[model samples]
Target chain A: MKALLVAGEKSYLNEISYLLKDDQFRKSTKNMLLCYHSINKIIAKIPFRIYETFDCNEIGLFIGTSHGELETTKDFLKSIGIDKRARPFLFQHGLHNATLGFICQTLNHTGPAITVSNRFFSGEDAIDLAMDWLQLNKIKIAITVGYDSLPLGLENQVRGLYPQSTQLSTGSAAALVLANEEGVRKILNTNYSINLNNLFLERITYCRTSNARTGGSTSTHYYDSNAIEEIYNNLSRYPNHCSTMNLQKPNGTYSVINMAS
Target chain B: MIASTTPAVAVTGYGVVTPHGLGIDPLWSNLLKRQTCIANDTGTGIIDQDILEQLKYSLPKDDGESASCGREKSLLMALYAIQQSMLHAGWTSLNSDDGLIFATTTGYIASWENELLGFLSGSRREDSFQEAFRREPLGTMLADICNGLNFCGHNLLITTACSSSAQAIAIASDWIRLGKVKRCLVGGCETLSMLTSQGFDCFKLLTRELARPFDKKRSGINLAEGAAFICLENESTIVDRQRIQARILGGGIASDAYHMTAPHPEGLGIYNAMKIALNDASIDKSEIDFIHAHGTGSYHNDLSEGLAIQRLFGEHSPPVYSTKPIHGHTLAACGVIESIICIKTLTEQILPTNIGLKDRDEKLKINLPLEHESVALKKPIKFILKSSLGFGGSNAAIVLGGIS
Candidate 1:
């Protein structure tokens, strides 16, 4: 099976609109839309010819989001009260799968659709699932997405872990398409595991690390881009590099996704 | 090339924590009497304060540190249901190869509500962030359930709105069929949250009275909360066939791309999903003996779902029923909860009547069994189909049946 990185885009909260190149897509998806739309915008950036070659009915979509649209969720929550209620739009788009449906409608793809979340390392899970679907030939073409947005209050909570990520209102989304044929990098093998250790909690409570600090964000969504960028940058040298990406959610569990490089 | 058949997965045991109470008996008995179990939420506040107050009384109290984190009700219900399921399946410890697929749309939202309160009031406590991280993250919920059940294998969390849990069951069965796992604990759980309660209220989707699916006087869904789990073992892995509650024939998931919240007017997604499920099971439409529909009582949902049923089964459509009036619309938990109901119907051969249906819409051609006396089938129910349609145009259908 071949894995192709068709389109990848990451937009911090400050620049999300600018990254959505299509004005019509942006206008239709602006309100009540969340991380899935960002992923759709990335998927939209892919060449139309690539989509034209395959029937939309033959394509499937799989997305992973750790903390989906925290900003919108918070907004919706804030609007609920005895005297007030959330807007119908917020009610419609607050769901994690809302974006998944929006992406399907936008692309006119009607194959199998799934939204999976494993906290911080969800991106790796999405990639791993995409490869499995391709191996099973469930779909001739699969669109995989990993997306999450950091709302306002969340940045202050994880500021210690993500010292390099100064913007609290930041989020990142990345997407790629894959098939059972040749692509940029061949996926030899992939493994994923969950580690329930106090070490993850200690990192949060004490911010302690043994080795040289690798500047990073604590978001599963932000790290989603890191994994994709790593694969893209090392596609040539990493013909057979076995590498593992470990991310720790605040819940004190370590999500490790291993790519047999 | 020849088409390959999906491996049949056996539903060894199941458990539920619903408004009717704990276990299968309570829910079944309540449904048998056509009794409506809608609870009122008169308490008005930022978080549906009364429901939380009632939860304190209804559910067992959390012992120590975790209680303060919030939304312990959902976690408690999930643990309770899983324990019952494990016991029914006659298992002690899950093998390292077993997987858990959990579904929920609102995971510890009450915990986040606390954090949001602190955020808005500018009184964010030093430990509030830690608490939100610990309690509100969906991963924490999964990890908690895994630890509670002593499971350490593959795990997946699905949040596909209302169809979440039904899809969870389908995926778990797939894992077993595809050799990814030997066994799986598949289910969905949901707890009352201010967000969805008010969201549905904003959309005016909540019925002022009891929800009546397919009834001409039907108003809307009654927002309810609960959790359910079913232990699914591969047919090849089962040591004894006598313990099988029902066999999972197949499942199909699809999207309409039609609208954000409303279903396609023609019920296109529902039709596609049901058709795919029948194909996956390698059965003709004539084989379906009964259907457990999504039936959320909204004007559009009922109409769309009814149209889909009519188009698919036509005159051959078997008995149809909706249990939301008895259990309320539990959203994410509806899939597994409703699937468990189907299994019980297959075993008992007594279908639950459609409660609160004073009048049926004449325009819809589907057969909805309304009278309690006529609910039970004279012959054994062989196969049952359960379906769910959620927000974002997501849809899922699964076929289950008595042991072959």
Candidate 2:
């Protein structure tokens, strides 16, 4: 039932400009293009032998985003307001699941694909769902991505809403390739015998602070969407150890990810 | 029916707020009467303003200091549906460990449009614009629902366009089966907005006339808006047999990996999803009494789904019907809303007909109930299948069984 983190990649702000020049991503919207490149990077990093074991039919794709296609949505809305007509392409690409479709089509992957949103905790939520699918033996491998592109003229608005938020002002995407023990063993080839415990997600927990006056709590915290990349960095740096990373926003809403070798 | 080894998942309670009216009573009655709720001029199904105002007043007032205040219409609809569902479940409050999975395609889009339009025109005040921007993110809807209901367990907001809510139900059922939670609240909410209607119109997917599913001259979909929630629990957790409404036999999800707006020409993805769902339910195709199709009345959607149905069930395909002609297509909310209708179908031993069909499309070659055909089963209805397809090639199906 263990989900091993086999490969990962990330892109932040200007680092994603290279995708804009690629012909393969020319028709892709910003968020879709960003995710496409990130997933490709993860695929490229996988060993040839392991990559050969991937079953396109059994691979699960999970995407998490705080504001999906906001930029395209704005453009579509503008078209409606000024021209009194909206573009069909913009309307199609403006959907939140458009990125999921784009990735699956480009990769020729037919699997269980879903897009989830939990604000700042979207990354963890995506990873958690991926892990559950793996644990349930539903798929051989899971590609989980967390992505968000801030809409134009909305950065200041976000900052005003969450003054202490550090990562909500920019656009970024992070991806992880996870597999169960049996799938990982088969992918690595039994002869290679790579340690399955090098790095794997052990657990995930989401917590929110309760309000005493209202008897209910609101999620006002905004945390980094690329926290998964940070977890990847920590696990790689300190091998053969257990690590617990606590990600907390100023408002006391936080999530914890347990990684172990 | 095939035997299942996995833990049984039960549907204990359900509620809805559709254009037909609030709750299942009005929707069922309207469907039986073959009523079309879409407005002729607007080509959309709109909920009454008085019902909305009454729902708003029934909800607890938000304290000014809370960030969850100033909610959008979609979130308000979701809260009202949740209220109805909880009350139907005979629970005054939710356990801290209960989970929630929400689905929506356009989250606060109307509010965002208003704010952005004002900001661009330079005629609106900045303070008012800022207030609108605060409610922009789709996740806020999930948070607001949690705060309103005091639900603090596992929760997620799914936005896979039209398939969003069906996938939410699937995931909630998975959670219950895996012992992640004893019970979960699964729901979808969508409110009419200029972006959706005009956007679909741009694609030429909106009907100029009435929606007619499986009809030779059927134009396209009639965009609509609503919210629905169904409470799913582990069958072992339910102590009262009278509380059980139906059993969630199984669910499956898959992507077409085809065009962004168009489904696979042959309906390969839809067929695979239905097959997987039947397998998950551990049942043979013959066990299903009928199917609630994602028949949007759009040419491509109806043809593709019909082909999928033909491919799966072959010559013995069960009677298929789409309620869009009655309630219009509610986009993301159709999955759960139609699911509630399926529950009613199983419990009542009645089958709804495809309302606006004047002439069946011969190319489909699938069994479709005729307009004005009212089918009341002499024996108990056993199982039903509900399927949904989204704009991004997302497809999902769920199997529900009547209580034995």
Candidate 3:
């Protein structure tokens, strides 16, 4: 594993209120604001020089939402079939790519922005997409985000899939700005683009059976929050140390983020 | 940005399930006839209605799992297409070394909608949630295909608005070029859903009447559904050269970031994508014989694409046409479906006419063929550029040429 650029992270939707509680909030619709809030929270943390050095066209964004804007979809459909009043705003904001599109527009970033959904591994998928693009030299800077709200309209339908104790909250999101390790000493190894389940199983087996250390030290941390913030925040704590954290999403997918120095 | 000489990706086999019918022959023949297939969707909100009824008179009764409901139509169509492509390529099985990348904007959305409607009507079943959960993840769609085919390989599902499958194909080619995989199955699948129909209607992006691309009075897009897949292999992996339909020379993708729904007025992203594709192919702008434009009949798309074409080809532009009217806009599936059109055009020496363009937009400077023509030329088509622009300002272009 090599050192990777760790730009920033966002743990909660409320943490982004600073970006959303402005005059722009007046003009935007509800879902639009929600999306912008989530995206803005991440990009706002990236160094200004990163944006300045790379042309907006050279930056990419990969976002994953398990149930993308379900409320908006439900509202649009219900309005059309039952209420007989179509809200164009809801329709526009309901798309799975709506947040990705908004983020591009917000930063004027022209590089390819992709939206991925993989049940519970959406966040890991976004990270995988970013790492692939970065390693391929497809983009200089990649902004990866994982966000989802409680399926308000379809809650009762999907709740059974989750453990009853799972705390699936509304407006939960996390972001990571990943870049190539040109001169940076810190590295983030995603072990990306592999069968995530098999990889998780292999890692678990290795951890349980092996006494070998990957780096000078090895440690495992488990966080209660699925925000990915814990991983980001703790990466700095273990400088020059190899660490791996397995995050269990409420939807039962384990997202493993590996960091090595 | 053109790299040194590299191996070209060959399209060995293709399968298309379009409104015209099953098989590439049906789609090609219909396109050659210049028939517009757009009609008022009668089964839009009905869950049990076979959305692909327009494809044929009736489907087989004993097809078993092959029979598709509105929601499963995309997967079923994709499976059929994949079966055809694999057989065409003379492959018995795909192991872990191969790759499968598919794209779609809607996966089981119709089923979820039905569940929602049922719940709203107080007719929901106890297992409705389980059924919906099973179909919720776009990844599950990939898993279903993988398990059904017994494929143990790297599989990726991309959803980049309208250009999802196009990007998927481009990435698959990149993977093959980079030696990440020996062979790749690339394509897209989409099934009609009320969410898309009403959503597009709300955006005013759907035309009330028939879709008319590049027409002076063009209104909006006509929504359609279908699935298409192509087997791509590099020169090293290609077993029989005779089966090569077309070769992917190069591809490029760019984002406009100008607007979410609207494109850059000057078509900067479109121009960049085409330019990069040409550069990547190491071909001059003059070598392109034809363009399969992403003319969705929307005013902004036509204007932007026309301007981009004018800026690139200037005086000696090749014939440009849109197949959206024939197939309606298949959304994510347009990339592979349109690429198949290009392959057929090169293979059969036939150029499809641009339907629904009675009167060209004089304001937009470009040549659109209103009548089908045979390319019975002295030589095969050397290069054809295909372009697809999506809702999020994502633009992708690929340069394809004859295998020879």
Candidate 2 residues lying further than 4 Å off, grouped into runs, are A49-52, A164-169, A190-197, A210-224, B1-5, B60-71, B375-379
The C-alpha lDDT values of all candidates are 0.69, 0.81, 0.70
lDDT of 3 at A18: 59
Report how far residue B284 has shifted in candidate 1, in Å: 1.2
Give the interface RMSD of candidate 3.
2.8
Error of 2 at B246 (Å): 0.4
> Model 3 off-target regions past 4 Å?
A1-3, A17-23, A26-47, A181-236, A244-258, B1-6, B40-71, B121-130, B372-379
Report, for candidate 1, the interface RMSD: 3.1
Across B1-404, the per-residue lDDT of candidate 1 in tens digits comes to: 00365467899999888866777887899888777667555211121345345444544455344433454678877877887787899867688788899999878886667666666666776566555655655766886777656567778888889999988887787778777778899898888777887888888788767788999988888878788999999876676888899988888878888887988897888888888788777778888888999988888898888899899999558877888888888889999999999999888878777887768887688888775437545668889889899888888999998975
| Cand. 3 Cα-lDDT | 0.70
Residue B364 lDDT (model 3): 74
**Model 1 in CAPRI terms: which quality?**
acceptable
Q: Please tell me which predicted candidate would have the highest DockQ against the true structure.
A: 2
CAPRI grade of model 2: medium
Residue B137 lDDT in candidate 2: 77
> Model 2, residue B78: what's the lDDT?
87
The better candidate by lDDT, 1 or 2, is 2
